[model samples]
Target: MPRSFLAVSLIALALAGCVTKPRPPSHLGATVTVAPPSKADVWQRVASAADAARIARIGSAWSEGLAEARSRGFGDEVKKEALLLRSGAALARPAPTPGSYSCRMVEIGSTPKKKVAFERFKPFFCYVEVEGELLTIVKQTGSQRPAGRLWEDDVASRLVYLGSLALGEEDQPKAYGEDPARDMAGVVERVAPFVWRLVIPYPRNGAKLDVFELTPVTEQPK
Candidate 1:
């Protein structure tokens, strides 16, 4: 063969070998590790102190108003005030004490072995008290703001209490429904010193339930 032709063929063969060589197995080769998703990945922390205060104020005001109306014999005025409080412009609550906590809703994947997935229908807020019951506020609809009426209307928020913590039980709102008497049962487990998990049963049978991992945005000294 001509020298030039021989050289060209050698280069071609080398290029072909380079192109056809199999890549090393990824497990045996250098690999990139990905961190698994955790509660932090899904749950959003509520950082707005003002928002927390506002919710607190609304709850307080509603309680006060209800008591006053009952004492003064002001019928329907309590309802009127509740309506006003919910529809009126924003109002601020007093600053939350140091150690108070607030939480925001987070989206997460459905549990692995369930036939159905539970859908979170509204935004939720949790307030941790230093010495009393833990307060939770859940909106009935996306349009509802964190106001007195929203608190009053939602059974979940209105009835949430930490009394079960003493008994080592999960506290949830009273389940009220038709003949079958559907109610939500929840269990609270401590994942860490500052992290907790809320496990609630799905309303429908054959559905995958979701567990909410809660992290405190504000931690008070014990």
Candidate 2:
């Protein structure tokens, strides 16, 4: 071989040896010491496309749910809970005191396929606790419990909620993205003194709005 050709081949080999393979974004498919996705990151993967859309357009839930209720002749019922049901009723300092709470579920609105425009379940027990940089809410008494963290958002008066349902006697529920059917998303706000509501729009159960009102349980002297 010519000296020049030999030199060129050596240079090519050296360049090839220096090349490196790119790293995957998620460290995907690498099982050993795999880094689990953060709770904040699973919202997109776990929530259904339609549900995500509903969360994105949460502003419409008030008008739409109320409209559905009024259309079905539930206006008076809605008017009765005016403060808690208002769309922009969130107050400043939206954080809730960490303690047990009395929670209730109110479902409003329906598609033509179903006739349930408004339904309110009896009060149940829930608990709020501090979790790292977020606050967590867990339904303490119910066949279907909701548990999730409250994330601070750009909005001033509300915190975004990303959670999943815990069924039966499960100790720890699957993470949000682990099950699409279990994933739940909503916004938490303080609508009245010592009162907050978690409003979920376009709930999978066919309701346009599913509001959970939470009020702290007063501590009594032992």
Candidate 3:
């Protein structure tokens, strides 16, 4: 062959050799083994001992107020005032010994209000160590707004503790006059091993009381 033809043939062969082979496609249906997260990895530390104790006291007072209100069949105004007094006293008293707790978001209870869905709320389950205090803090979750933004701009309470008790007021929509913005209390009773019931008096007079039946997130289907 001519020198130019020979050079062109050699270049073509080198280019063919340099071309990379195509890789096989990955298996779309293949099972992926993801190790479950370790307890340390999943548990989040959100509050210190002092903070937890203060919150607990506030919650306890609220719970007590609710119980009293229900027993007396008090009106809305009476219940609200009672809660205020209880919460104030709780704060003024000497702080109790601080306790430690590990908290994680759990399931919320169902509600009739169409605007508010319990599933959307990311409530917390706190396993406490200060004299065996266990409580749950129910708060709205999955909001597009930035962190630190208040849920619905309403200052209602949602702290429920063991011993069939809870401290926190129910949230009333804006359509209703201002949210009570008070610390209320109620009962947290265990219906089953993993199932719990939360009962709180309705903030509005003559309205039906609120009841929440909650279960762990692990029990929910994927």
Candidate 4:
């Protein structure tokens, strides 16, 4: 592994997060101290066997998601954001700094027999927090938020996200496996300078791919 990537990744905290906890200030630029991971990788240790299996097929999800989106007439739009939509556009140093971020969601490809192929949601606020040797990215705004941790992978350019949705304003997010219906899985990759995206492929909801673009915010909501 490259020294720069390894330095950032080795300290990335992984696992799920809750809304009520008093987490540290996740501001950007400070180096965090992390306990070394055990012999088994973090994802392999924490992810449910079934979800792990699904994430393993992320490659297929991207392939099919793009194909269906184009078939449904979103080819032009998909082509427009090639960097964010492309499956292999991941850059190095997938570890994200702990901080508040501006997040936007865009969906591509409709499920079979569905006509709603492309969709975009207004930008929202998300947060990245670290605890132990893992990092959690959770949508700080929006009633329906996905929260999960980033785990290292052999692929090098991306980290696996295993988390669940926090429905409503007060409901705590179910852990990645507590509720099979709400489980969410994806890959977190840096697509550009200080910008990262979480791509949830083969999603069970509105579309095939749920792409969320995340950029750190200088000012956070009070």
lDDT of each: 0.33, 0.85, 0.33, 0.83
Q: List the residue pairs that clash in candidate 2.
A: none
For residues 1-222, write the lDDT of model 1, one tens digit per residue.
799999999999989888866888988898788986542222112212332333334434334434443444544443443322231322232112223333333222233444222223332444434333333422122232221101111222221111111111323322222112222333333434454444332322332222344455544323
Show model 2 residue runs off by greater than 4 Å.
1-52, 219-222
Residue lDDT tens for model 3, 88-133:
3222211111222222221121224422212112343332123233
Per-residue lDDT tens digits for candidate 4, residues 22-129, read 667768557999978752366778877777777778788788878877887889988887788888889999989999999999887776667778887899999999
Model 3 ranges with Cα > 4 A deviation: 1-134, 140-180, 219-222
Candidate 4 — which residues are off by over 4 angstroms? 1-41
Per-candidate TM equals 0.27, 0.76, 0.25, 0.77
Q: Model 1 reaches what TM-score against the true structure?
A: 0.27
Candidate 2 C-alpha error for residue 36, in Å: 23
lDDT of 2 at 33: 70
Full candidate order by TM-score, most accurate first: 4, 2, 1, 3
Query: Cα deviation in Å at residue 44, candidate 4?
Result: 2.5
Pick out the ten consecutive residues of candidate 3 with the lowest summed lDDT. 145-154
Task: For each of the candidates, give the backbone clash count.
Answer: 2, 0, 5, 5
